[model samples]
Target: MRTNSFTLLRQMVESGMGIGIVFGRFLQVRRESIAFVELRDLPFASPPVACCRMAGRTPTVSSEAFAAAIKTIFHNYGG
Candidate 1:
């Protein structure tokens, strides 16, 4: 059934068999795939990135240091 398929897919994502297909802006990179296409175009679906929230208080750090750290990590990964 369709519900069963959805449950299995959710499990796959949670178990790291694959990454969840997300849309809007949360994903670091978005791939063009069937799941992406379907989810993005679904009339009943909410904006994927909008579902998340700030988990805790913001870190106390200068913006420049945060930017530098992000840049370093991305550069190291060749991303």
Candidate 2:
């Protein structure tokens, strides 16, 4: 099944339907019926979350300041 299908299954489980399997590191916060089963190990990978601006508009000074503050917090936290 596709990742979209898995997401739909998770939604159904959240909505009280009794079909489908849901699993992930963050799913622990979900209900108890949503079991956390291990699947076969695969190479670990994820996409980066990048920030970009439109050609006509620049990010505001406040936005830049907020980003810098977040970076400073992460650096202090050893992220």
Candidate 3:
């Protein structure tokens, strides 16, 4: 089973349906019903993300800033 919802994933894990593999950040503030195990040594790559806009459209200043912020975050991640 696959879902985009973290809440549903947590609920399934808490209900003992199965285990979930998510980023450790999501486990920072969590309920006690489930025990989280961080797989730091696992060789998994994060999926690519994009900041997309319609073709030939001019980006707003806020959008440009947001893209820059995202780029900075990606560069600094896991460092």
Candidate 4:
């Protein structure tokens, strides 16, 4: 079964229809039925990414400010 909806995927996984793999940040693991396991032994891992603006375009004032705020927050919260 394939779904373009994450809500359906989460629902099915929670209902035991199947296991679902999701990016850690997007996984709403608030349900008691779901347990997350880290893939500690993966050969390599990619850093998380966020895209605020496209290349060659001027960043909007709000977008630029928000991006900087996110950067500061992440930097302060970095492990």
Best by lDDT: 3
Candidate 1 regions with alpha-carbon error over 4 angstroms: 1-61
When 1 and 2 are scored with TM-score, the better candidate is: 2
For model 4, residues 57-77, the per-residue Cα lDDT tens digits are: 455787568656755665666
**Residue 40 lDDT (model 1):** 30
- Candidate ranking under TM-score, highest first, comes to 3, 4, 2, 1
Candidate 1: tens digits of C-alpha lDDT, residues 40-59:
32334355422121123243
lDDT of each: 0.39, 0.44, 0.53, 0.50
Q: What are the TM-scores, per candidate, against the unseen true structure?
A: 0.24, 0.32, 0.46, 0.41
| Candidate 2 lowest-lDDT run of ten | 46-55
19-71: candidate 2 lDDT, tens digit per residue: 34233343345444444333232233322322222223445787578656755
Give candidate 2's error at residue 71 in angstroms.
0.5
Q: Candidate order by lDDT, highest to lowest? A: 3, 4, 2, 1
Error of 4 at 15 (Å): 1.6
Using lDDT as the measure, name the better of candidate 2 and candidate 4. 4
